[model samples]
Target: MPKKWFQNWFNSPYYHILYQQRNNAEAEFFIDNLCEYLKPSAEANLLDIACGRGRHSIYLNKKGYDITGIDLSIASIQYAKQFENSHLHFYVHDMRYLFYVNYFDIALNLFTSFGYFDTDYEHVKALKNFQKALKPDGLLVLDYFNSNKVLNMLCPQMIKTVSGVDFNIHKKIENDKIIKTIEFEDQNKPYIFKEEVKAFSMGDFKLFFEQSGFEISHCFGNYNLEEFDPANSDRLIFICKKAL
Candidate 1:
């Protein structure tokens, strides 16, 4: 397993943009869809794991749910804390050992952030941690890339600008894994970073959630909460429930 190289996000314009756009057009879609699906209590406590910058936390808090977000990145936590309403709080912590058993009524892991672990074993460990943190019969939602479609819709290179910096991203696929190389340029200086992981299929994730003690409640193809077909989906959203 390759080590995760996530440190570049702070100075990397690419990551900064992603962090700033944390509450972009997709925010309402994810918030409304998940809320509608879960029907969370006005008083329910929701956990946003890997919640970089707390966009989801802010939105859910506005809707009257008590939200607590956790992220491994301190910078991201700082960004998230900016939107803290009375009902929202954020911490820098690992989601793999949440330490809050039977606690959250709803938990969300969105935007393909769930697979940064070094190994499949560790991946499942985090899943079980999510299971542990959820109240019995609580809902857990995951928004991820549709692996099937990702394989076909793969892009080799793309350029985008964010936070007044230009980013050049390159992707390489090798043996069920994706290698993402990012080059950030601001004022003619270039800084580069890399991160990669083995991408698993939806069936694999379903088995993972099952082994982690969750039952699939729903799966969607897009941000609009539409049904997913393996061949055509741009996104894969899974709404699961803790097995009673």
Candidate 2:
């Protein structure tokens, strides 16, 4: 059997090189705003799902929270392990499987991380796993691109040169999925990878949450915590709580 696109591409060293320019400042700003709004207890336990490089976990740990970062990429987890301490830890784990049961005060699936699975059933299963990880009434913060806005403003093709590698990218929506094809040549070798994410809308997520035993507490349009506007928001951020 072939490996999933994410399992292959995300573990590749080239993936880090291509995305090396991801803005730390922006991430920090968003985290700060989220903390201000959520105001979790100082000793709260945080679970960062698909925590690439453990950036968010490390910052949250610094803020006096007990943080656990988990990702499927072994390389990413290895790099993140260097920052581990009594309050912070990293593990290579799949979101489709259960981790801790009723252990965390908050669970976060950030940065458009929820839509990669091939089936709605799988996505819902992942959400249930997240739900299981949290204590009763525990919070879950899920951040994803606003599919409506993104499909409306889809760019068909582009070339991005990062670290001297020219990545030729093509994107399209097919079969209710957003597909991105990336191609690049490095060290005289050609490589290609595809990323497919379900173009889930507010309605779709509502159903997922309902099935996963969660109730939506708040919906934000952006990292600033503005009210969600389906047609205008750049992001779809959902704050949910375990349902009684």
Candidate 3:
């Protein structure tokens, strides 16, 4: 769905038809690496901002960390609550303005979790919120889609089927932004969805993070922990530390 679809579209015909079950593979991939790098004590406090489905929090809790996940999607939070553990909890909360400040040993923003806001200011607010929520010398890990790579890889059209429903998808990019339309059909009855995503270069994020009081410590193109190659990498994993 388009930018507006994120407004309340999960209940719309679009999400119901296409939002398939996602495994913990993506979350586990990051958490395993994060644990090895940070070497957080068993008592370290973690906050998973925008934790849809609580995948990361669940995995971390199993690894003996104190975890809390917050997301605005009730549907996603509900699914997350099912796997709650003694040291893990999930709540429905917005990330644009977090409710806590200077409380977490670590904060995670993973799974291409950046850039859904209508404006760059909102996204900046998100980064500032992360800074405010982090303790002194706290670590924050950000995993986001590489804007350049995605835009360059943009395909004009795609055809596929899920649960017997056929889908025809098209994409258009102009002026550093992407616009997409999806048409879902079953028995020839068509259902349409549109999505708009802002494309920001890697430098944009680097400058933004610097202004938000964060210093880049580690940056990777993908979960494999390989060196960052902006043009070819799909995911950008950033490990930034609070400057203060």
Q: What is the lDDT of candidate 2?
A: 0.93
Two-way TM-score contest, 1 vs 3, winner: 1
lDDT of 1 by residue, 1-244 (tens): 5434764453244576645655555887778877786788887889998887777788788778898998888787877777876789998888777558999998899888777666778888899999999999788898888888877878999987776676788998876788888887667877888767567788789889888989998899888888998999888899898998
For candidate 2, write residues 21-126 as lDDT tens digits: 7777778878999999899998798999999998888888888889999999999999999999999999999999999899999999889977988899999999
- The TM-score, computed over Cα atoms with residue i paired to residue i, of candidate 2 is 0.98
State the displacement of the C-alpha of residue 29, model 1, in Å, after optimal TM-score superposition: 2.2
* Residue 37 Cα positional deviation in candidate 1, in Å, after optimal superposition: 2.2
> How accurate locally is residue 133 in candidate 1, as Cα lDDT from 0 to 100?
92
Model 2 off-target regions past 4 Å?
A: none
Least accurate stretch of 10 residues (summed lDDT) in model 2? Answer: 21-30
Residue pair clashes in candidate 1: 53-80
Looking at model 2, the pairs that clash are none
| TM-score-sorted candidate list, best first | 2, 1, 3
Each model's lDDT comes to 0.81, 0.93, 0.80
Cα deviation at 38, candidate 3, in Å, is: 1.9
